[model samples]
Target chain A: MFKIAVEMLMHDKTKFLGLLIGVAFTAFLVTFAMGYFAGFMTRGFALVSENSSAKVWVMDPAVSSAEATINMSDSSLDSVRGVAGVEYATPLYLGDVTARYANGHFQSFQTIGVDDATLSGSPQPANLLHIPNSVIIDSGGTEGKLQTPLSKKDVWSYDGSHLQAPTRELRYGDVMLINSKRVVVAGVSHTIPRFPPRPLLYTTTSNFKRLIAGEKRYITFIMVRPVKNITPKELAKRISQKTHLKAITSDDFKKETVMWFMINSEDVGDMVNMVVLAMLVGFGVTGVMLYMFTYENLKQYAVLKAMGASAKQLGDMIFTQVFISAVVGSGIGIGIASLLAQIISSPTFPFRMMWFAPLIGFFGVIIVSMTAAFISLRPIKNMEPAIVFKL
Target chain B: MSKIIASCKDIIKTFNSGEAEVKALQGITLDVYENELLMLVGPSGCGKTTFVSVLSGLLSFNSGVCKLMGENISAMNDDELTTFRGKNIGFVFQAFNLLPSLSAIENVALPLTVASRKRAEILTLASEMLEAVGLSGKEDVKPSGLSGGEQQKVAIARALVHNPKFIICDEPTSSLDHKSGEIVMELLQKIIKEKGASMIVVTHDNRIYKYADRIVHMEDGKIIKVAS
Candidate 1:
């Protein structure tokens, strides 16, 4: 029966090709979307992921997203660092500040205040550890400009909030003049994202305290890394119990980040997957068309039935045909999806396609394929043996 | 008393196509004695085909007492009818009804395969039957590659493979040439004589009627004569 099943598919190559393309394309779609979603999702927590060196993030209970934060007293820092499972709690100060450049073009940048005690403390390419007056920015700087002079513009404008401006392009050792304070652009990095814009400024935690110019809270968030096999959840539970703030694991933060993106903003993860889903739906529609290829040939199925084939055997014929289409089409679809994903690769994209995505995609193809095959079988199942003798 | 292989009384079949009901068969009666060759002969639209289909357990009659080898066919459920048909009746169709994807021997061995026998065993049995049908050398060729007569011969081989008590041939030679048709008729006569199984052949081709030991004629739906 299997050999016959194989023969039925082989004997009709054109129909099989249609189904294969349909199934493979469907597989590619689902796989690509899931992969990108995974990849981009990981990036949403880049600040934490790049710095998961910290085991837990300490934030106010009302904080729903990474950007939505309230400060706890720097005094609470002592209690967090002193928790039983906690080896050390690094102080982090985060807030958005528009860095106005000398070029007159202003860009919104996030200022994270940290010292040598944390993971993001060390600047890549050039070290800013010794520069108490310096700040670090990503990949060149605003307008692909990096290693330029850093000078802060006016702070405490008419609104009484500290929104300082600096030079747009920052190269190493560049100095920036800010509101009543002088910040030297000591280090430049690439691809690390902050909340507001392309240019990120990292400075000493102490300087971050004095430069802010407003009544401050604790830290934007705390980054902690467990010493051993201690699960992040257990540690977070303990920390949450000890403090009045919420302590969340990095993975939980990642999920929250993705959910926040979905709810409040247009995340690249959702966009990429939405495109993939559209393609998969196209493949399903195409699969329905491919089924017509088999449906048109249903008279042949009736002939098989009249030849002493049981319902199972007849159904198997349709199954084998559908399976062939799924294997080929899914192969094509995933292959196309993967190739497309690779074609559009960048640090900002967070495009990640994995194997399981395609595996699940195959199930998708099989489901639609089987549905196509089964629906096609309706006409054949309704076939009457009485017609075999008809004129 | 000879074995009463099959009997039907007061059989009715109606088909609801659209808003109107088409009555194909009404009040038809039939009987086949053991080892007797019963032929259903009539013009077109005479319900000859419908009569055989219902008697073969492929169609359900609205009202009837239809029995195959004394088992009530009308009362049998679908699966029961299937099992009954598989055990007791074999069919031969005019268009040769061989699966095109399967080789000639595979076509002959289909009944055995449907019964869930091992391929090797069924193939061996099928080969023996093909040889019996004068098709000893053409076992591996599919139905499409064979001649009309050869295809019909394969169908005949399939019927006899199960050693059933009754054989149903529905226009088995209608699509064959005169020589091929004669060969099929002769083969059927020979097989019935050898196995002592009753058969009912529904056909309008009077040339094949000589092989029938008993002939029943029908028109519109009712049987007009039973000539012995």
Candidate 2:
């Protein structure tokens, strides 16, 4: 009987292909939406996620997340370090700075200032990030080439009107002006981009203070490490209670960042809306296609009924057809989505295909297919075997 | 004399369209005996199809006693009727209504498959039945690829493959030419006689009248005459 159902579907090749395409598109939309949402969530907390060495973050009492925080007084770092269950604390400088390339192209960049001595909170290797007047640019942030004087030994000279160096290293030796002060690119740091889409750069806290003259005595956050036996949550509690400042564990800070993004960012809300709309469109296409296919085969169902097939048998046949289509369609859809994910492999694009996303699409297709089967099998249930004789 | 395999006592069926009511079968009373080929002949819109439908338990009559193999069909619920019909009655349609997706053997094996029979057993029996119907080389051919005569032969094989005690064929030869119709009628008679099974065939093709043991004439939803 299941063979009969499969054979019937195969006999109508045009309709069968139409059904597969419908299901495949539905799967593609569903999986793509899920993957996009996942990528957005990861991007929303990139700052907290990349600073993995910090167990707790101390900031102004009014701050909600790492991205939307007021710069706390530099004295707060000493207060945080003095609290029990806190091993050490370092000032973290975070702000935006505009950089003018030697080529006259200017771009806005998000800058993170790590402790000069400890190199804590830096997104790159300590040796590369701790160098004076040196900065690390995010790989995905720059638009085009950043030309600089060719230099290898970090020495500079002038030849008439041109800047001269002993070596020619294009991206590594790039020189740019930050706040009208010359800065050299030490290396490129491959890191995830945060929201607002600004290029990210990392430098020493001393250099950050030097670049921004008026913002000398303030810091955005104090990165703290808990004692050997104490957890981040316990240390955060102690710090918050002692210093009267907001102290969030790294994990909690990640959640806070994502929550702040969802509540504050219009782009996050728009991505969620897009996901819902994709689901609606997928469900609609699958439902209508399955219903129309079953309706077209109603006469054959009547013939089967007239041949002494019970309603259960007929119903089972319809279910078998829908189930096969759903499974096959999901497979093709996921395959296509994965291929797309691979092709659009640019780090700048927020597209990440999680392993569980395809499972969500699979279950969604099953539900839609089952709904279609139930609705389409209604005519078979009420069919009279005598109808075939009249036909 | 043969014992009666099916009997209809004053069976009545009516079709309602809004306030208009049409009687399709008006108190049809008939008896089909064992091992005999009874042909019900009538013009279009007569009660011939309706009577056979009721007798085969495919349709419900308003007020009548319809029995097959000594069991009252009206007493059985829809499910029971379906199982009873599947086990005891076989049907042939005017259009040679074989499933286009299936080959001839698979079409013939439908009844057994519906009964939850094993695939191996069903295929063997279906192949034998197709061979018995003189379609030995056409077992693997789909109905779409076969001619009208071959398709009709496949339908007949399907009807008899289950070894039902009674068979009802509605205009079984109407879609075939004279030579094909004669061949099909002869095949049906030979198979039914060999199995000692009774058959009631509804058709307007008078060329195959010689194949019937008794011919029943109907008009305006009522039986008019009987000839032997």
Instruction: Give the clashing residue pairs of candidate 2, or none.
Output: none
Q: What is the lDDT of residue A101 in candidate 2?
A: 60
lDDT of 1 by residue, A1-391 (tens): 6676676676656766665665665677677767766675555566776665776787777776675568878777777777777766777777666654443334556677775454354356434645676777664123553423243433223433333345244666555555646677776666544332355667777667666767657477776665576777888888888887788987788778767766766555457568666756866676677678777666556544544566777777778767776777777887887888788876656567756777776777777777788787776677675565564
True contacts kept of each: 0.27, 0.66
User: TM-score of model 2 relative to the true fold?
Assistant: 0.84
Going through the candidates in order, their DockQ values are 0.29, 0.59
- Looking at model 2 chain B, report the run of 10 residues with the lowest lDDT sum: B52-61
TM-score versus the correct structure, for each prediction: 0.83, 0.84
State in Å the error of residue A212, model 2. Answer: 5.9
